[model samples]
Target: MADYVKDIRAKVGHMPLVMVGVGGAYIKDGKVLLQERADTGGWGLPGGYMEYGERVEETLKREFKEDAGLEILSYRFLTNFDQEFFTYPNGDQTQVLTPFYLVTAVKNQPAAFDKHETKAIAFFDFDHLPEIHFASHKKILAYLKTLL
Candidate 1:
């Protein structure tokens, strides 16, 4: 969670707040990158919330670097959806508007990932993807299926 979000939650308690975030499906050799999130222990794409003054693409790039240490070389727009409601493990309630993308990684060597956010990061075959933890990500993958 960003400091700005925390500041807002301080006043709102558990009231649902609208959030905008971005994520990417990074494909390589017919596999997509996934991260096992430390918070949920479920596999999902590399992403995080948009910070103040950040563009949507900047949010995706920054999150992928922070969570997985990978640089996004290029990306194609996938889809955008609004999650009606979600309650985090820590009791934060939010209605998230998320934009999804299909991204290609840069050739630069990646730094070590932030263990606080990701338990593990690896690639998985789309046909045999792990159980997706987030409903929004599942919907994005389902849309990717049509393109494949």
Candidate 2:
């Protein structure tokens, strides 16, 4: 969570809010990269909420580096979905506006991910993906699968 969200939660007290989210869809050798999230203990795309004044691509690159330890070298827009509602285990709810990307990572970056937000990182075949944490992520993956 970002400081801006925390500041708003302080006033709203768990009320639903709207947030812009960006994710990277890193596909290689018929597999998609995913992260095991520390917060939900479920698998999800390695990305995060867009901070105020940041471009969507900037958010995606920053999140990939922070959460997956992969630096995004290039990216192409994949899809956008809105009104995706999610409730945190702690009870915070938000309607997320998401834009996903097909990202290419810089070569030689180690997979030393941020332990605070991610537990592990792996690439899974779309057909054999582990349980996805977010329903929106599942939808995104399904759509991406069709492109293969």
lDDT of 2 by residue, 33-101 (tens): 999999899999988888878888889988998888888888899778896999999999999988989
Q: Worst lDDT window (10 residues) for model 1?
A: 104-113
Alpha carbon lDDT of each predicted model: 0.83, 0.88
Structure candidate 2, residue pairs in collision: none
TM-score of model 1 (CA atoms): 0.90
Measured against the true structure, the TM-scores of the candidates, in listed sequence, are 0.90, 0.94
The model with the greatest lDDT is 2
Write the residue-wise lDDT of candidate 1 on 107-139 in tens digits.
478566789889999988889999999887787
Question: For candidate 2, what is the lDDT?
Answer: 0.88
Model 1 score (lDDT): 0.83
Candidate 2: worst-modelled 10 consecutive residues by lDDT: 104-113
